[model samples]
Target: MFKWASYFLCSFAVLASKGSWATLQDNNQTVCILKDAPNQCGSFCLSALDPMQTNLDAIERKQGVITSQLWALISRQDVQQKSLPSLDYELRRHTEMQEKHISHLLAVQSEMQALQKEMLHSILDVYKKLNAHQTLVQESLDKSITKEVFENRLEGVDKQLLTIGSTMAILMSRSVDQPHTVQNQSLQSPQASLQESLSEIGSEPPQFEQIGSRHFFIEHNLRLNWTMAAQRCRQIGGHLASFQNRLEFNAVTAKLLTGDVYYWIGMNDLGQEGQFVSVASGNPVAFFDWGYGEPDNLGGNHDCVDIAHAKMWDSKCADEERFICQSDNEV
Candidate 1:
């Protein structure tokens, strides 16, 4: 189509130069045909350009629509691009928080484990002490007698002495009136004969071991429950022994026992689960020698205390044991 327009314009320029049909002028920007004579060239050129003008206007309107759509697409892309940084920030923040929470949880778990391990060790230590003392206690009990039997034996001996002393006294009084020479004989008085007989028997009452102005005793030949032992001590004008210091505890404990055995002390928590008091003084114990993890109160029945190997342990109150009696009275 452009070739046809060019061919017609060139032909019109040639026809105007050669014939008296039209005048042609070049204004540098466009070609113009002067209608000096009534010429059809200019009119044909105008008619040709009119159709192309309409097509150009439609193309311009289409270009404007495309430009508007392109701008809208760019705007949407800009909005999406602007949101990425904030999304990344939120993701990073959540990750950091989660990491911190995990770290804290791990730390707490470690602490709990440490505490549990320590507790287990403490329990094991207590159990070892308990087992050792229990075995010794059992052995001691096997070699011991009940307090009642021991007392009965002593009472019988006393009765025998009383009768013998009376008989000797009567016989000596009669011999004194007769006046017979007794040579190389030492039986002169009833008290002397009684003492000689007692010496021959080689029996003496249980004596307390004393240290630092304190007297305490435990008969290895006696086995009694905690309550009975305490009652027996009271009957003997004393109470179950309580220690004021380590020196007194050690001194009395070392000498008062003939063999290894757990001995009941005055210390007990019968009135309260965790509070120990001495029955002798009825006050809180002034000293303590509790073994590791002691007073665990196994079975919740261990309100009494036993002293063994210089350490205190909780024991069942009803269990029989050897016990020391303490008396502050001067002998």
Candidate 2:
């Protein structure tokens, strides 16, 4: 019995040892590959390495994408930060300059407006004064003349008025381009119309002439003797009728100065010897064209007498002649 048991134990121990050695040998064999067995070991290694390499490559690509995105974000942030102050500064500067310019423009407009107002007021005052003077002069002349003579004088005055009208028209046209002055200028046309209306009312009824312009009725019945005529005219704001050029003389002659009766004229050798002085201007009569031997101081006592009707003699201070006055349309 003891012998059998010992043999059994020994055999069991040997079998156990053999099994352990076989397992170890199998593991070693798997670990140790033959150099020519590349198809087996190489395939195994390549498969594992390929998976690892693919994972690494994917990771690297993800990293590169992330870095590029980050850089783009950073560049955008930098540009915004740099431009913010510059854009803000430019905006502020533009706003400030605009405000200044607006203020300056307002100031200039105010000054120009004030200047225009001043000029308008001044012009209005001058126009009023001129109108008043004309009225007074016209009234005086009306009170001293014969109808025919007054009518004729009115015609002559109308001619002079035409010249003044033309001059005023020219002045207005010249000022048309000045819009700043237009406000006052616009008022003048109506004012002139009023003055003309007043003139029409004050004068005798108008008469249409064939060759020349129309004539207003004369303010006749202001007859005075020779010397008294001039004195009255002066007191009332006029003077005895004065002759200018040959044309004017002819016009007067054609109109009939005082019917057939001799009448006084405004011309006389008052200033320097042989030179005639107009009572109106108190200046030399540069336009005088006397009849033959006129103011030859002919009668020696003819200190003031001149040819009247039909080349006859009339007293210098005689109130027989109609009175006339001179004035400017504009102040």
Candidate 3:
């Protein structure tokens, strides 16, 4: 489009120059024709024709000189016109080159657009694939983490179970060795040995003995619970007896039979928690006996009290055990 506009401008300039040249030539030719015409009348013609004819003749002479100058201008114009085609050819060539360059630019632009579109789609696809890959990897990692936690917990449980089993095995083995161990323990602890000696000897009647102000006698098969046994002793003018001190508890413990057997004494359930009160008054008893945690209502059924001088003070009120009775008088 630009090339055509330039060509039109160049052609218009050339045509205007040619038209001006032609008009100048025609006017100069008419002036020259008059300038060359004979002045046949000469001076007479000049006088009779007035001063205007003389001026007219001088104008013609000037016109002839102008006509010669105009002819020279025309010749130069013609030569310029002959050169214009080459200039036009150069202009057209330049226009063609510009058109080619514009075409190349458009082609490159189209290719860039196409490449940009393809790149955008590829990037989107890659992003989607990356998101999917990350999701799968994260899921796998989560499962692995959960499995590890469960496995660790299971391992800890297995270790704890093993420890418990080992402990149970040791307990069972100790239980299996208990009778022999007890026989050996009889040789070590004086209390255990004395009971052993009593068991070795045949059962005999209690040689009535004084332990403090109270007197006592041992009996065979006087079966009763701790409560009833205390009642029996109370009927004889005293309560079911308590040990005056450790001396009495030890002395009585030495005479009893051993093995799955128990003995009842004069002690009763006082019901005072730490201090045993006398039943006669609610006052605290002057004496008491307890193994560690004794009188603890363990097994939820030990509200009653009894003396097992060899082992502990017990509360198996339902047991039909043998008895040891106490009275105020020497028996």
Quote the positional error of residue 71 for candidate 2 in Å. 1.5
TM-score of each: 0.38, 0.29, 0.32
By TM-score, the best candidate is: 1
Cα lDDT tens digits, model 2, 164-264, are 78877765543332223323333457644433333332233223233222121222444445555444334333454454456555565554455544545
Q: Please identify which of the two predictions, 1 or 3, would achieve the higher TM-score against the true structure.
A: 1
> Highest lDDT: which candidate?
1
Better of 2 and 3 by lDDT: 3
Writing each residue's lDDT as its tens digit, candidate 3 over 186-289 gives 13344444434333333332345675555776656667666555544443334454565677777776778876677765443445434454443334445566
- Mind sharing the TM-score for model 3? 0.32
lDDT of model 2, residue 28: 72
Report the C-alpha lDDT of model 1 over 10-116, residue by residue, as the tens digit.
Answer: 57665765544223223233344454422545566657677886898899899999999999999999998999999999999999999999999999999999999
Superior by lDDT: candidate 1 or candidate 3: 1
In model 2, what is the error at residue 1, expressed in angstroms?
64
